[model samples]
Target: MIVAAVPRFRHIVAEVWRPLAALFVWDVAVTIVYYRLPFHAPELPLTLFGTALALFLGFRSNSAYQRWWEGRTLWGAMINASRSLARAARNFLPEPHAHDLKRTIVLRQIAYANALRCQLRRQPVDAQVLRFLSHGEAEPALARTNIANGLVDGTGRRIADAVRAGWLDTIQQTQLESVLVDIANAQGGMERLKNTPLPAQYRFFPTLFTHMFCVLLPIGLVETLGFATPLGSTVAGLMFLAVLRIGDDLVDPFANTVHDVPLSAMCRTIEIDLLQAIGDSAPEPLQPVKGVLW
Candidate 1:
């Protein structure tokens, strides 16, 4: 994802150049027709169209931003839930074994975060993920269809073992279980956002309207701008299409795009916190490469 401190014009142009090129071509064609064919389309209707298109684009952008915000909030909750679970394990479990088991469970939490991050992005588990899992758990977790679920399962088993060994009483077990349940809820929310997209019509209609607006823009402007119609229309067209593209970028927050929620960075933050909680010197938190945290 792009993390530049200032928005770069070159990057913006690179992303939507094809569509902008089409807009430029359409505008030039309309300008030629206005001068050569002695034909002029009324501009009044174009004004109304632009207004409606603006409203439609606004609604679509808002909806997409909501999805992105929800994804960020869910990850924030996961961070809190993970810390709570580790704190509970450290406080409630009995001695020497407690340290080892707490560390084990914390490491599993880290692995789970990485697994979920990889799953959402449809990427292979990274070495950072394997580093957090025990030798026994790592291979099996990697082999599973849902690696995050496998890690969660291992976490549950570890909780069971703690209870069975009387390291934690039923009340303490229940507390830890509650935190686990919250983690699972956060996971389910993440999966829901990843698996379900905005309605097709929602994505389709706004894009259609934006392009329609771009096509008609030069036609409307040709009579007024004369020779300058092409340049004016291209600039105007770029604005409307840029908003539409921004909405598209935000609609899928897990796609690992520059505009996504920075899942990798978030996962790393959780790892750092959990690792430090267990007295291990955690790796430094990830810094944005350009201006992007991911």
Candidate 2:
């Protein structure tokens, strides 16, 4: 996500340049037609039209922001649950006897976080995921349609094994299982946001109305603004255009754009914490590149 206090001008311009260019051209054409041709500028209720358009854009923008925020919130929950799972695996499992097993479960928790990140973004299982899994473990998990869910299931089975081996009692197993459940719930929430989109009316109508308003703007103002029609109309139309673009930019938090939730950085955080918990060296935290955390 964009972490800069002030985003670059080029980034802002890149989002709206297409519509901005179209509005400017259309404004100029309308001004020319009014002055050179025998066209009569129609008096439009521009003030009322702009008011209604602003409300439409405002609602769409709000809905999109809610989706983006919910995605971030779900990941925050995942991070917390991952840390809890790692701590439980390290402390609950009998030391020295279950040393290797404890480490395996903790490492697999890290793998699960990375796998969920890749799954949400629809990316392939990279080294970030495979490095934490043993050859035998990776094969079956990768074969499943949902790798992250499979990894979570594996962790639960291992916890159950520890109970059978007398490394953990039934109570301790339940506690650890509860943490895994929290992680699964967080994953489900993220999947819901990624799969379900804003309704068609919300997506289509505001866009249609905003463009229609821009098209009518120059004609409505030509008689009153006269030679300044292009300047007045283009500037006015830009406000609505910018707001329209805001909704589209925030509509999908997992789209892997700069505006998306920083899933990579978040997964790295889980890796660092879990690796260090099990007495292994961890990589440095991910830093923002060009003011974007993704």
Q: Highest lDDT: give the candidate number.
A: 2
Candidate 1, 1-294: lDDT as tens digits: 557767678768977899999888888888887778877578568878888999999999999999999999999999899889878877777778677888888889988888899889988875756777767767767778888887887788889998898898888878888988998999999899989999999988998878878877887888889889889999988889889998989988899877889898888888888888878898887888766668
Task: Output candidate 1 Cα RMSD.
Answer: 1.6
Model 2 lDDT per residue over 129-231, tens place: 6888877877777889999898899988888888889999988988998998899899999999999999999999998999999999998999999989889
CA lDDT of each prediction against the hidden true structure: 0.85, 0.89
Q: State how far residue 133 of model 1 sits from its true place (Å).
A: 1.5
What stretches of model 2 exceed 4 Å from their correct place? none
TM-score per model over all chains? 0.95, 0.97
TM-score of 1: 0.95
Q: Which candidate is the best by TM-score?
A: 2
Q: How much does each candidate deviate from the true structure in C-alpha RMSD?
A: 1.6, 1.2
